[model samples]
Target: MVVGSMISQIELVLNELPESEKKVAEYILANAKEVMHMTIHDLATKAEASSAAVVRFCRSLGIDGFPALKIRLSAEVENTPHVGYFDVESNETVHSIIDKMLSNTILTFQNTASQLDAQSIEQAVSLLQQAEVIYVYGIGASFIIAEDAAQKWLRLGKNVYAISDRHLLAAAMATKSENAVFWGISYSGETREVIQLIKRAKEQGIKTISLTRPGNNKLSQLADVSLFTSRAPEAQLRSAATSSRFAQLFVLDIVFSAYASAQHDFTVEQLAKTRKMIEILYD
Candidate 1:
């Protein structure tokens, strides 16, 4: 059986493999289930190659070696049926609607995994931590994500501003320098106002970061550090701000958590102080 999405990856580089390595790749793709239990020597022998050739094959796929390749295979099998948008049928029952919505959200998160890269996430966190101020700009539903982001960073004592108005965001961008950061949120990565704000930040020599769906778009292309969320395709019912919104939030939560973790002591103290102040208001 074709093991999982790895098959597609293997196929993509199939033609590029040397003749002997091609044998091993073909063997793995054809016997994916059986190969999961096989050692490198076992695979190499079966494919009429040596253990070293198997290692070479694994590296070609960007995997560390045979063991790591097998682990990836297992995960692919489990994570198959990759998330795709599913439209809600007209006149659907309330129960079905609930299930559909929950399923869609779950799929959105799953899809985001493929869009994210470790290097970009780490770089974004480091930039966020180093910056003295952060300006977040978005419009419509994306602005809600910007608000959520500002609130999260604020708890950690980061100076995060979520500005929905175009003029205000541009003004804030104008006053900032490279010491500040501009974080733009646009699912399509083409939100005009958001784009202009990030552009302005860049003009002021501010570092710019962006969150958008996975694809080439103006805003992401404009920012210094471009980040991507899941690509939720258009569907009749899901054509709204459903999957993209969740993906953006997921990315923001990850970045915020990473930032907070990096400065654990300070973040904890800030959280405690904020909590106490809020509690006093309620009391």
Candidate 2:
């Protein structure tokens, strides 16, 4: 299951969840689509959870209550295409493998787009635009996405930095002012290093932005502006991170493009200047 997806989140925290909540989570995962239409009491009976336990399960997911959970579950259930992540079979031909990879890429963008919250995105962009400097953080695969984010904004002349070193990041955060913003990118939203940096940034009154898979996570919870990407289920090949990367970049582009449009003349001039600089390097 995808790390940030609803079912996946329940599963990730299932082992640590209370016995009452575990029952509720198991029942929901087994009957995701059906749970959307089932009443709280009905689900409680099936899961052997008390009505209060059902409410707690919903809250654990960062949802308001049973009714809210149903609304969210309904959206995911109704909109999710029947096609999903499939593991490559041992004897599958190369052509079949290619087709599946391409399909998953297409579906990842579709799912991520459908799950995006417009208001949250607006706030994220606005914060970026207002910031005097933007510090992007990530580790491993997420660090690649953060670098891309920094590159995209740098071309537009935005003051952005993608810092991958934990020690250096902590040092930089120590001196950051309130005018600077911290953007943490982690698909699981639980990366220890990123979370620590965000905490430091906050102590200095720096606001934070987060790019994560849709659901509740500590990093996202700490962020002032939480942006989400599509969640892809896991496979033996671990294509979940691959598709999730695309979704993250997709969100980055949306925010970057919007920011560029707001300062079109400046961005155009900067693009021309950067192009000229590249040509000079070639000379």
Candidate 3:
């Protein structure tokens, strides 16, 4: 099987592994590519398990041995590039802050561009195009992203809503079905309220998409389509969040534009009509 298939397999059987094996499983799931570069001894040490346990874990996954597992992991690592954001230091001068933020933002765009798959993006656009309604949900800083998504879709004459109130959003979701699409934006991919809403959407048969930092997180596990932003580690200055959020929003804009272009004439007509309405109101 290919690396992607192996990943799906691992996700499927993760919870079924024995306790000793579960530790190894969790670590591998979280750091598949990193583990590929490590020796059995290294993996055991890093996972806080034993070499024998590592072998057993591989066996549970139906791989021949550690080498085979490593090969699969290496394939996955090579296929997916890692992107990370750094924070500025406290007491840094103004010039230093500018430099650090610039470096972080540049790296973020580079990393995000490298990992993005055009086909998956097209699929996302297709889903959005077919949906009767789009509901965007996020918390805190991510709420800003949700609002941005709503505004973009609305501009295209799509029925889009961004609900800031957690209770009202959950209630609204309960009324939506497969015709609706729920977009959950969370940098951590483990926001409790967002996760709950995702589950509710799933129960109601609504398609779900997630935009989050790449990691083995709850949101990715739950969503139908998972679009990742570059991971941004926490810092005292909170510069990481600032850069990562911009990167996430950029990816969202790309998806929206792709969808709009697919319906070029319709989009043009919609824009013309909107402009005319605004002109009439203003005049």
* Ranking of all candidate structures by their TM-score, best first: 2, 1, 3
Clashes in each model (backbone N, CA, C under 3 Å)?
0, 0, 0
TM-score against native, each model:
0.73, 0.78, 0.69
User: What's the lDDT of the predicted structure labeled candidate 3?
Assistant: 0.79
lDDT of 1: 0.79
Regions of model 2 farther than 4 Å from truth: 1-37, 57-81, 175-178, 279-283
**Candidate 2: tens digits of C-alpha lDDT, residues 1-283:** 1212454446545776789999999999899888988999999999998999999887666567898777766666676544556567789899998888887777777667756677887888888888888899999989998999889888877787787787887777676665888999999999999999889889889989999986678999999988877666666776677788888988888888877888889889999999999899999
| For every candidate, C-alpha RMSD to the true structure in Å | 7.4, 4.1, 7.4
**lDDT ranking, best first:** 2, 1, 3
Candidate 1, residues 1-283: lDDT per residue as tens digits? 1132455456545676898899999998788888989988899999998898898887665566898789877776556653334678889998988887887787667556655777888899988988989898888889899999888888777787897778877776676665899999998889888887887888888998999875568998898888887666556765447877888889988888888888899999999999998999988
lDDT of 3 at 233: 46
- Considering TM-score, which of the candidate structures 1 and 3 is the better prediction for this target? 1
As a whole number from 0 to 100, the lDDT of residue 161 in candidate 2 is 79
